[model samples]
Structure formats: C-alpha cells, structure tokens
Target: MRTILILSMLFCSIGPANAAKTKKPKSEEQKTLYAIGADIAEQIINQFLFEEKERPYVMKGFQDRLAEGKLDIEVKDYRGKIRQMIVDRQQALRNKFLDEATAREGAKRFPTGLIFTETLKGTGEKPTLKDKVRVHYHGTLTNGQVFDSSVARNAPAEFRVDGVIACWKQGIPLMAVGGKAELICPSGIAYGKAGRPGKIPPYATLVFQVELLAIIK
Candidate 1:
C-alpha cells in the first residue's frame, strides 16, 4: 500500500517535465500544478536518496508509464517484486553497515548479530531482565538520520530490560549502571521486516547510543 502510494505520487510529478518540453505554462492553475509537481519530485528524490546511476532507469520507467501509456512489465504483476527489490537493497545496505560496525575497535558481535561497543566503563552493577532501569538513548538509521532520542529531549526513559526490542534486551545487560555504549542492531533483531511505521522503514538496521542511568529498585 505504501509502495503504491509513493509510486503514484512520483509518477504524477513527472507531468511537469513533459509539459516543460512542449510549451510554457500559460495559466495560474498550470503554473501551480507545475510547482506542486516540482515539490513532490524533490520529496521523492530525498526520500529514496537515489544515486545518479539509478536516476535514468527510474525516469525512464516513469516516462513509459505516464507519458507513453506503456509498461515493459505489468504493474499489478510486478508491484510485489518491486517492493521485494527495495527490501533486498535495504538488507544489503544493512549487511554492509553491520560488517563495518563489527570491525570497529572494541566492538563485540554477538551470535544474534547485535554489535556492542562500550564507550564509557562503569563500576556499578548491571541490570538483569527482571530489573527496570532508567536510561537515555539516541536511535538512528544506518544513514545517521535520528529517529528517536531521549538524550535530545533531556528526559531519561524507564523500562524493563526485556520490554524493548531484541537488540536492546541483549545489549543493555552488557552495560552497568552509568555506562555508555553504542549498539548496532541488525534488522533481524531490531524491528525486522515490520519496522516502526512512519519513523522507520522495513529492513532498517538501527544504531543506538545508550546510557544506563540507574536500575530502579
């Protein structure tokens, strides 16, 4: 559903380019439509973070569907495949990031693919799954775009050790109270295929900076 909506908006935005090649915009409505399309085009570019090499193929497909009323493949038959391609690409990116993160000095790669690197050592006690703890965390995607941050808000979050994602459940135990660590969670252990909608996409690898503030009694 989301993929369909994105493709629809992107293809609609191609109209302005076709119009530009033909003639100048003469009416207020045409000019407004052109501006709207330009904005949508910009949004799509930023959303995909598409590379220069991929732009031509994307524009060709859009032109074929919108301007030429033709398709090399049936849309209904290929939508699922297209979505899978996106998922696979995201997974590849995640794998690359995981490889680099695990190679970082002091990083520990667990069997579950969670990478933990302690930045600040703590002498205090560590919390178990049964314990509720207070902490501050900054969460981001592989691209370094922050999705959530208790640190930015200046408010610590409190929750049980096992109440969060699998990544945190495993990574937090490695930290003692007052410790800070970087947790790089592979998609399989962090939200997986069904990511937190609107804030995270499917197959996203999450990076987190976590500070264990206290273990609440």
Candidate 2:
C-alpha cells in the first residue's frame, strides 16, 4: 500500500507535460533533455527509497507543502534534518560494533575512540607523523560495506601519516613496517559531519584493514 502511494506521488510529481498527452522526443536535443529529466526523476526516487519506511511521513509533508502553494521550504532546513538523521543512525551502529569488537580478546581501544586489532606483527620500526608511508588498505563502513580499497586497485598508497584522517594519524604510528592491523575509526576522527558525499555518508564510522609496507621521510 505504501509502495503504491509512493509510485502515485512519483507519477503526479512528474507534472502534466509528462502525462499521457505528452509527445515523445523526436530530435537529438529533445532526446538529451528527456534523458536528463529521467535522470533527475530517478535521483529523487532513489533518495526517498533509501529510507522507504520513513518516506511516507516525508511525502505527506511534501504533499502538505504542495497543497499550501505559498509554503516556503528551506533547503538548509531539510538538509540539516537529513544529516542529523544519518549521523544519529551511524553513531548508534558505530557504538554497537565497537562494543562487540573491543570485547574480543585481541582488540584494543585508544583514548581517542580508535579501535585497533593486529593481524600481523612486524619487527621493523613504526613511522612517525613526519614520515610518508606506503601501505595497502581496504576501508569500509561499520556495516561491512566497502567504500575504498588500495588492495582492490593492486597499488599501495603513499602519504604522510599526519596527512590522512585523525584515526590514521594515531593508529598508523602504532603499526610497524610489514605489520597488518584493523583500525576502527569513530566519525569524529574520520570524515565527521561532512562525509565524502556519495561515497561515505555523514557521521560514518570507518573500518580499515591496513598493511604497513614501507616508511620514507
């Protein structure tokens, strides 16, 4: 029933020109415009569908605004609301995961909310913040969704320890060359409020399986 309502609202939102009486695109320019329109519509649909169970209330609010005609909707207001929702959800999941992870025998948590678990121990010296290091890493959200991976690229990444996120600033220094460790970073030490947009959502906790290769000043 809710799905039907969502589809109905989507069709209605397409406007009268897109209704049954509309003519099909006839030229290249017309076709491009039609495609762009479809893309925009798809984005909107996907946004609502991301949280479909909560979308009915959102759609009802939108409908009320549309009916009022003169209602002023502030973009900042809605954006902030959405950001806060994402932050709250992400933080809750992060806390729960950290609790479970730190309960494991070998897992350790830092004072700054960074969680580290060693996979391989190394005998070489650890890198300092002033030194650049080459490493391979696979990064994911707390929900086990991979966001980025140097391992997947089959190339090691080189960067100064301090140049990366706050979590890496502290955690990487603890890892010696040839060591492999898993680092769980809280949002405050990761992307924080302004996440990597489409790649990482707001207030997302990041988990990285990092292998330290070489350190160079």
Candidate 3:
C-alpha cells in the first residue's frame, strides 16, 4: 500500500514543477573552444591559403601550435625568415620611392617661382589651443601622387589649428579666411621615417596648397 502511494506521489510531482532539471548546466568549455578555434581557422588560414576541405587539418595544426603559446615563425624559425624578407623588400621600396619623389619636387619648384604666390598679403591669425577651423587643401608627395584634397574629396577638413601636424599648425594660421598659401613640409614635419602607405614613401617630404576657407569659432 505504501509503495503504491509513493508511486502515485512520484507521478503527480513529475509535472511542470519537476520537469525542469534542478542542477545548473555545466559549461561546455571544450566544445566552445573547438567552435572558437574553427572560427579563427576560417578567418586566418582558410581565407588566406586553404580550401574548405583543408580546414580540419589546418585547424588541427593550428591548435597544436597555439597550445605552445608561440608561433613557429616568431622563434627565429624558417617562417620567421620569410616574413623578414617580405619586410625588407617593403622597406627598400619605401626608400627608393622617397628618393624619386624628392628629386622630382626639387625639379618642379623654387627655380620657376611658380610654387610661392606672393599676391595675397593677408596676415595669419594664430588660433588658440581649443579652436577648430575649416580649411581647403590639396596634398601630394614629391613623386606626384596626390593623397589628400579637400576640394577633390568635396569636403572640408575641420581640425584644431594649434594641435595638428607641425606643418599644418605652422602653416594654416599664417593666412586669413579666403586667403591661399602653400606649404612644403619636409619629412620631419610630414609623415616621416614611417611614411603613409602607397601614396607617400617613407621619409618623404610633402607638398600642399591650402586655402583658409573659414574659421568655425
């Protein structure tokens, strides 16, 4: 009789109240790790070098490499040497580009007196540290690669006149609104030892023709 009663109670309790499992679900760390590993593998290796079928094998190797917390390439290994070669080539190209750009700009400017136009005689307004002003400009490297131009981009650049690159801070405030000026910034004032990619080479001087469009404040 007691056993029958206990069985009845058990059946009654097995409704929604007891259908829920009581213990907290354990975190599936290893499963999550594998999924994360698979995602990273798809991004780095599969995107760059591998086919879809190559993922598992590549993932297996990557997991093993990561367990050691060291990339084989970074330990003075063969892979490291190959990476170094690529870097060396990039640096060499940068140097060659800079030399070519400087030579070309030197040939184009100063002698013809075409660069510095002395007609607009308005004095420059020195801006305070917090003042942002609008300016129109065209920028290029000595190699004649035009990088930035407010007019070409059809937008005006607003920046703190007292806190931008040395060339800008020094050159922009020397002209009044509606006045035009030219700046030939050396590599030191421009994108110096490590030049901006593609357009400007490393250690390259920059040339700019700027018009002070308006001062916002």
Give each model a TM-score.
Answer: 0.78, 0.64, 0.45
Which pairs of residues have clashing backbones in candidate 2? none
lDDT per residue for candidate 2 within 122-199, as digits (tens), equals 778899999999999999987688999999999999998989999999999999999999999988899997999889
Return the lDDT, model 1, position 170: 97
Q: Give one digit per residue, the lDDT tens place, for model 3 in 170-196.
A: 666556777776666666766777888
Candidate 2, overall lDDT?
0.80
What's the lDDT for candidate 3?
Answer: 0.58
What RMSD does each model have against the real structure? Answer: 4.1, 7.0, 19.2
lDDT winner: 1
lDDT of 3 at 52: 72
Ranking by TM-score: 1, 2, 3
- The candidate 1 region of ten consecutive residues with least summed lDDT is 7-16
Per-residue C-alpha lDDT of model 1 across residues 1-217, encoded as one tens digit per residue: 4754565546555465665685666899888876766676666654454789997877667767666576787778977876676556656666878899999999999999999999999779999998999999999998889999999999999999989999999999999988999999988899987999999887788999999999999
**Lowest lDDT 10-mer window, candidate 3?**
106-115
Clashes of each: 0, 0, 1
